[model samples]
Target chain A: MIVYLLCLLLFCVGLYCILRKRNIIKIIVGVIIAEYAVNLLFILVAYRRGGRAPLHSPDAVIENMVDALPQALVLTSIVISLASTALLIAIAMRIYQKYRTFDITKIRELRG
Target chain B: MNYFAGMIPFFVVLALGGAFLVSLAGRRLKIFPDIAGLLTTFSLLLLSVLAVIAVSGGGLLVYSIGAWRPPVGINFVLDGLAAFMLVTVNLIAFLVSLYAVNYMERYTDKWKFYTLFLLMLGGMNGVIITGDMFNLFVYLEIASIASYALVAFGTEKHELEAAFKYAVMSTVGSLFILMGIVFLYSYTSTLNMAHMALVLAQRGTSNILLMVSILFIMGFGLKAALVPFHAWLPDAHPSAPAPISAMLSGVLIKSLGVYALCRVFYNVIGINPALSSVFLVLGTLSMLIGVFLAIGQWDLKRLLAYHSISQIGYVILGLGLGTPLGIVGGLFHLFNHSVFKSLLFLNSGSVEYATGTRDLNKMGGLIKKMPVTGRTNLVASMSIAGIPPFNGFWSKLIIIIAAVQAQEFFYAFWAVLASILTLASFMKVTKYCYFGRLKEKLKGVKEVPVCMKVSMSLLAIICILGGLLILPRGESLFLGKAGYSLLKGTSYGNEVFEEVNK
Candidate 1:
């Protein structure tokens, strides 16, 4: 129960960083943090108190195995996050080249 | 035609294969990308038409990946709604690719654009066809990420800024969606949507389901650019190249945001009075706020982008009423909006191509110079503003009538007000950009090339013929099937399961 709360806390921290940060790189990092927190929460959901490694052996009776699906899913989620982060970083680099600043406040060419 | 069932997976296969083959051979063979893109999207369009026929015959069509049965393996489900969206997505994709063939000449690295464009098409097809929750998320990311790159394709100052903001907000939305999926999986212990729906029906609802619903509303609403979460669209849509703006505005938001939201809430979770009310308020807010914000914009593309928001609100309003007529009106509007909106964006692209500017204030008497573009823009503008005999007028009328029928009088009034304001704003566009005195700077501008002309004319012709889609006979083949599926709601699970057994 406490572990789940901790994961929620971590997610909030990432959301705060994303919402409150003015630096472009910091916002990107905040997205990364939020992504990791969600991935972590997914892993925790699959965790069992005293489960085995979800491996099968003819010699041993299978019992109390942890859910393996979320683990596999987390790997895919991580790859997706990696791709988005790389793209965001590339965009940030180009924005810096154009506007010469990492502060999002300074990059205001588009508006209503 | 038993083999018709087998063609379901080919939508994704053809698109992904085409994307890969284009990127691989495009560098060496410059013309290959164009041919491949045209062929793949055109084939996908034909397949989607066949899908509509297949579904109209009755019963769901389920394709289990790796021959794995549902609740244990991922499957692809093609029903009325999926076929509807597939047709909409692929139709726009084919036309946009055709437009891009000529319009893209101004930009360097045309092969790269085709590669990303095809990939995004594949992603959207995947999202529409997939039967599992996690599968939807994966495809949604695939589509969203490709669009992010495409929006920044110019790699200029404003493009990068828009793409960055779009990427960040979209990623955050995806995370919220992922979180919602995680919650659903944890609650139901199943990933297949049909199976999950069955489980929820058997187990009954809890607070966890409510939380998941809230998360989805936030996530999908942001993707749809509904009132409160619509900050990125005006910037991103105008910043992307025109054909891309057409695709993004035309199909991406519908497939990723509205379609997903409807599928999850109505099909998986099952809509109730409370959920329906939430949709009502949100839809109404988006309708009024979006139009009010749009009327003052002078940038042509940006104005059109803001109107995209307002039009989407009509779709949501119709669907949220949760009546058969409402669903029919909403689905019909969805198709009509795609036609006219893409046409409008393509027209804007042609103007920019000729005059090298997108400001409506700077364009004048363009009809005297570029007659085809001007005439097509006039058709699209009339359609979007709900003028008689145009497709937009029919759909908006249906939505308002359905709203009044449902006794949602206030919403009906707002819909009418938005329609009037839409006309006023579009009239401003016509007066300033097409009918006024010829600008000195734009005097030497020429008509756009053949391919752009052909594409714009095709869409404009559709805009004119769009109202015919709602005729009694035409309704059964098109909007009726899509609306029926949404009206079926959670019974969709039973339909899929029954089809899987066959």
Candidate 2:
């Protein structure tokens, strides 16, 4: 329960970094943090106490095993996050090339 | 017919393969990207027609990814609603690809554009057809990520900024959806939508399902640009290239956002009174707020983007009402909105192509110079503004009548009032952009290219004929089946599972 609360706090912190940071790279890092937090939560959901590896052996009796699905899901989610981060980094590099600044406040060509 | 069912993977493979080849040889062969993009999208159009025909008989068809049965293996479920959505997505995709043939001539590395566009299309079709929650999320990300790149395709200052904002917000939304899926998976221990629905129904109203539903509402609502979550759209829609604008507003949000929202709420979760009320409030808010914000925009695509939000409000309102007529009206409006919204966006694209500016203030007397574009704009504007005899009027009228018949007098009143405001706004658009005196500075502008003109005219013709879907025979084939699926609610699970087991 405390661990879940800690995860929620970390999620909120990442969100705060995203919402409050003015640096483009910082915000990207914030997004990465939030994604990791969610991924961690997903993995944690599958954790079980005194769990053996989700493997079968005819000789041994197994009492508990971790949920394998969320781990598999997390791997996919991590790959997706990796792709988006790469794209975000590429876009950020281009933005720097265009504007010569890392501050999002300085990049104000589009407005309401 | 079974061979036709097996062709689903072919469409995905063709588009992705073409995208891959284009990206590889884009530099060496300039014309290759254009031909490949056009051919790929055209074949998708053909497959969409076949899917529609197969599903038009009001039965469900399931395509197993690897001959894996449902509740264990992944499957794509095609029904009336899915077919209708596919036709709308691929239809616009083909036209937009054709338009891109002419429009992207000024841009270098056109292959990248085609690749991202096809990837986006593949993602949308996957979303529309996939029967599992996690698969839907993966497809949604594929589409969303590709769209983020497409929105920033120009690599200009504003385009990059808009893309950054769009990418960040949309990625966050995807995380939320992923979180919701994790919760649902943890609770139900199944990812297949039909099996999950059965588990949920047997378990009955667990607190976890309610939580997942709220998370989904937020996630998908942000994607759909419902009033509260609509800030990203005005910037993102206008910042993209014109064809991208049409695809983004036309079907991306609907397929990714609205379609997913409805599928989860209506089919998987089973919409109860609580969810219905939430829909009602959100729909009404989006309807009222979107048009209000749109009335002041001078940027043509920006104005149209806001209207997309407002129009989507109508779809949600109809669906939320949960009556038979209301469902029919909502589904009809959904289809009609895709048709006319893309048409209007295409018109703006043409206007931008000829003038190189999207500001309405800079584009006057274009009608004198560009008759095809001007005339089509007139048709789309009239249709969207709910003028009598055009497609928008029929759907809006059906929704209003349905609202009244359901004895929701106040909603009906608001619907009529919103329609009038819509008319006023579109009138302002037509008068400012096409009619009145030709601007002295804009005298050099000519009509758009032939392909662009052809695409716009085809959609405009559809706009003129769109009201026929509500006629008796047309209703039975299209809107009726879609509405029946929604009205039947949780019974969708039974139908899908039954078809799969067969």
Candidate 3:
């Protein structure tokens, strides 16, 4: 229960960073943080107390092993995050080039 | 045919393959990207039509990846709803590709454009067809990422800013969605949608379930641009290239946002009265607020983008009513919106391609110079405004009738009110952009190329003929089946399991 709340708190922190921060790179960091928090929650949901990796050996019992499926899923999610983060950085670099600043308020060319 | 059912996976393979194929071969041949894009999207459209035929009798076609059965492996589903969505998506995709053949010539790297376009198309098809929760997230990201890149394809200042804002907001939405999926998985102990639906049914509702539902609504609502969550759409939709604008406003939001939202809430989450009412309020808000904001915009594409939000509100309102007629109306409007919206965007693209301006004040009496684009715009504008004998009118009529029957008289009044406002705004568009007087500087404008004219005319004719789908005979083959499956509700679990057992 405590772990879940902590995970959610971290997620909210990331959300705050995204929403309240003015720097483009800081917002990117915020997105990464929130994403990692969610990924951590996925792992926590599938975790087992005192569990080891779910490796197989002959005549070994399967007890005390964490669920492996979410780990695999986390791998995929991480790769997706990597792609998005890279794209965000590339866009940020280009934004900096065009606007000459990392502040989002200045990047206000396209508005209602 | 069973063969067509097997062709489900082929849609994704062909699109993804064609994207890379174009990228590799387009380095040498300038025209190769156009040919590849047309061929690939045409085949995808053909497959989607065949898909509709395959599921005509109202059945589920399950394609398990690597021959693994459901509840264990990810599967691609071709049900009545999926089939209906496929035809809508791929049809617009093919037309947009055809339109892009001419419109995209203005850009420097045409091949990269085709590659991203097909990539996004493949992602949409995957989103529609996938039966696993996590796979849906993956595909949604793929489509969203490709779209972000496409929005910034020009790499200009406004384009880059719009792309950044869109990417950040959408990625956050994806995170919310992922969090929802994690909660569902933890509660149900399964990732397969059918199996999870069964688990949710057995377990009944809880605080955890309620939390997940909120997560999903926020996540998918943001994607669909539901009023409060709609900051990114106006900027992003108009910033992309024209054909891309057509694709974005046409089918992207429906397939990625609305389609997924309906699938999750109605089918997997087991929607009840509370959820239905939430959809109602949100739908109504989006309808009124979207058009109200749109009425004041001077940019042509920006107005169309906001109208996309308003039009989607009607679809959501219809679906939220949850009656069979309402469902049918909603689904039918979904199809009609795709057709006419794509045509409208393409018409805007044609105007831009010729005149190099999307400002409504600058264009006038273009009908005299560009007869095809002007006439097509008139058709699309009428359809969107819900004028008679066109496609939008029939669906709007059904939704209004459904609202009255459901005793939602207030919403019905709002619907009609929104419709009139829609007509007024579109009349403004027609008066300003195409009518009035031929401008002094615009006298040199000409009709678009053969491919673009052909595609726009095709969509316009469909706009005229689309009303015929509501005829008693044709509804069963298309809209009825799609709506019936949704009306089935949680029996959806039994339906999928029953199909897999066979």
Candidate 1 global TM-score: 0.99
Instruction: Give the alpha-carbon lDDT of every model.
Output: 0.93, 0.87, 0.93
Give candidate 3's TM-score. Answer: 0.99
The whole-model C-alpha lDDT of candidate 1 against the native structure comes to 0.93
Interface DockQ per candidate? 0.89, 0.77, 0.92
On residues B25-133, what C-alpha lDDT tens digit does candidate 3 reach at each position?
9979998999999999999999888888898878888888898889999888888999899999999999999988888889899999999999999999999999999
Model 1 chain A, TM-score vs. native: 0.96
Candidates by lDDT, descending order: 1, 3, 2
Candidate 1 true-interface contact recovery:
0.78
Report, to 2 decimal places, the DockQ of model 1. 0.89
Q: By summed lDDT, which 10 consecutive residues of candidate 3 chain B come out lowest?
A: B1-10
Model 1: CAPRI class? high
Best by DockQ: 3
Q: Point out the higher-scoring one by lDDT: 2 or 3.
A: 3
lDDT of 3 by residue, A4-105 (tens): 999999999999999999999999999999999999999999999999898999999878988899999999999999999999999999999988999988
Off by over 4 Å in 2: B1-3
lDDT by residue (A3-73, candidate 1, tens digit) is: 99899899999999999999999999899999999999999999998998988989999879999999999
Off by over 4 Å in 1: none
